[model samples]
Target: MGEIIYLRDQHFAEFHDKCFLLLSASNHIELSRQLTKTLHHMLVTKNTPVALYHYLPTGQLRLIYYFSFGSNIEYEDEISSIRSFEALSHSQLTYYALNGEHETWGYVAHPPSSYIGSTHWISSLVDIAMHQLGLLSAKCIDRQQAKLKTSRRLLSKDIHLFTNIEEILDRHRQRWRDIFHACGICLASQGALHRFGHCPSDHQLLQQLSWLSNDAEQTDVIEFEGSHQGSLAVKLSLAGTHHGWLLLFRDQPFTNKHVDSAIHRALSCWLTYEARMARVLADDLALTIAALEISHTNRQFITTAQQLASLKPAIHSAPRAVTSAEQNNK
Candidate 1:
């Protein structure tokens, strides 16, 4: 709809040995699949090795497509190494957010000399694809935000009606697990904070929790490097209402900033549930005390009534002088 954006001529140097094209698209799975198909077709025609990398903003990077034209030993080794390690490290490809909304998809390839012209054509095609993908990304992000908003509202409503602290903690754990799964991360452990109950015995987690208790507002994410390869703790607090921490561990160290908004929403729900449970527990205790007091008061009243009835005859004579002489005197 607007001016078509293209990579500048000078930027071609970066694509000399290998080419990279970043598509600001959120439908990564479909787009990657389509690109793979197109590249496979190109491979069939040009007979070269091509690789497409699809990186989602949620920290998932996959080699969605790969094609090899011939059996060059060196090239095969390179492809094998890239497959094993590229996604694990940031050396081969660079990933950054696009306008803080879209993910950057990277493509790299080693084309044969015979396919130079075809490579140029593919680059031009990708330039046009990037623009279209950008538009699609914006729409996808909007839809995702709407869904997240709806989920938050429902969680908030449910949280306010919660009466058990355990339920709140369980929900918190499930939320962290879900978030980790969505981000393609493996979660080791997660739970609500407690002074002496059910908290992880790991020193790192305890230290993080101590720091969070000291100043919950200053920090949102804490990192731990210890027995666990990568441990992260997010501070969860609601002023005087509730205070807690969420711990997540993974095999590799990574930042949680990508899902910060989701974490905050989850923490809000947990805080609401915790506060409601505290009030419910307090109400239950008060009711129990009141019932005990009422029961004790009723027992005392019954005992006093019985004692008065026992002394009733001594306190008042009932028709004691009802003889004929007594009646004449009266």
Candidate 2:
């Protein structure tokens, strides 16, 4: 069993307790569905723009979800990669293949080495995940008559069946929350976070988060000061469309010790959840539209058939009337 670590961030600690309470009674997919619904409400209430990205085994990163308030950002570009889900990095090209640890949910890279969070915690998650995988793999091998290679291939092909979109979204959100808890301390001093544009150049920091971009990325930042008179500002760029950053500020000059780490943790989770929900909603919309078209077509066909059947008696009566008129003339 994995040991649960305490998050020292006050706000995050409260949120985590709430999350544990929410998750205790439910399974994984149910928890995620609830989380997405809750996150959507939060997005509307908070009026924040958030996006989620999932790392693919492929070198590219895909945008799984996003939620924006009054921001001008569009989710898709019907043509090319303009707004169409963009790929940020290749898996093999990165250090994840070498020193990085993999987990049932996903890989976690800690700071000093990586900025996401604790590498040890990430490694532990990976180990447990791998153990589960091993058990699953054994079951497959026992049930099948094929050799190990064939069994492996069969299991790989069916992995998606066992792990669907909802599970991925849930796990992704949770891992992101942990990362935020660990990394949130950095951005607590920042002010309200909002959507912004990104820089075109490849940034080293962005590269680690799999956000490296040649073209300018969208920027999201937290302005250090409120709508008051005068205040100094510091910016923290977050991972989002076109190099988005989060800005933090203070009314009076304050040190980093005053930062609220809990909010940062919450934001991380919110961003990931929002992104997943966005993609799922987009896909759902497409499916619903298609289903509606099919239903309309079927309805029209049924109406036409009914009308044709109703006209049959009238045609038969007309012929008989003509025959009777001919007999009378004779």
Candidate 3:
């Protein structure tokens, strides 16, 4: 027998298809299930426990399927007097049945025997398995890319309606509230940047023509300390920095695919909205400064023109008085 390793249910889902493929080929479902249960039992072992997994062609750990007998168990409280295959580490094993290694049928637990040989069977199994998994992974990645593309387009359209940051925040407040209700946590988050000339995050930014800081983003988190609660934290990045983040948690976290997708889409929309708002605000500020400069220039022109008008009369009177003095002397 071999050792089974402990892993969470979500972790199991990650490699579920691959493991099932191996088991179905060998008709080893019953054996695999028993092995998983046994692994759960050995999670709290005080002594060294065997780690069982198949080495993939990609040089990555795969099917790290199970662990061994232990003094206690956390997964199952009431242990039945069930005897499954015992797990043993390589050092403890007397022999390894290399013939047991195959694509459909993984290497099974065997009494230790000493033999060092690399056969075509092990190599072929790894190659075929790697190809199949690689294709599956590629397909998944493509689907995700499509979803993100669609999400970005929709969000960009929605953001155009918001004129300013205050409007964006107000409109999204309800959605944020709903997110909190669903996720079981609340995060009061904001983004801040000083005006171009006033920005002081870095000395270099001050010298630059654009007043934007090289890097100045803040992210804060406060976890929920409630019973049976779980939280999901996701940060949305734009232009190489975190522009926004979403905080969600719940007493009983909903694991539905639809809910997760909706949350993700909404967060993306919020980030796009924020970015657009910032641009609009910057444009408005520029307009305001130009207006102020024009007003100041007009005031100075009015004062200078009035002074010139007053000096004209004084010059005209001085010429007449000089003429009258010369006539009296003659």
- Per-model TM-score on C-alpha atoms: 0.39, 0.23, 0.29
Candidate 3 TM-score to native: 0.29
Ranking by lDDT: 1, 3, 2
The lowest-lDDT stretch of 10 consecutive residues in candidate 2 is: 91-100
Q: For every model in order, what is the number of clashing pairs?
A: 0, 40, 15
Q: How do the residues 65-104 of candidate 2 rate in per-residue lDDT, one tens digit apiece?
A: 3333332222222111211123213221111211213422
Give the lDDT of residue 120 in candidate 2.
Answer: 45
Off by over 4 Å in 2: 1-100, 103-285, 319-330
lDDT per residue (tens digit) for residues 42-104 in model 3: 222332222223333322222222333442232211111111223223233321222223332
Top model by lDDT, which number?
A: 1
Give the number of the best model, judged by TM-score.
1
lDDT values, one for every candidate:
0.41, 0.30, 0.33
lDDT of 1 by residue, 1-330 (tens): 223334455434343222233353345444544444455454444445454544433343334344443444434434334422344353432222222123354444443434333344465446545555566655655554554454455445544555444444444444433433222212122243332223345565566656656864544444343343244455433333233444544432222332222221211111111222223322332333333445567779999999999999887876555689878898
Measured by TM-score, how close is model 2 to the native structure? 0.23
Which model is ahead, 1 or 3, in terms of lDDT? Answer: 1
Give the per-residue Cα lDDT of candidate 2 at 187. Answer: 13
Q: Which stretches of candidate 3 lie over 4 Å from their true place?
A: 1-20, 23-128, 162-188, 191-242, 247-330
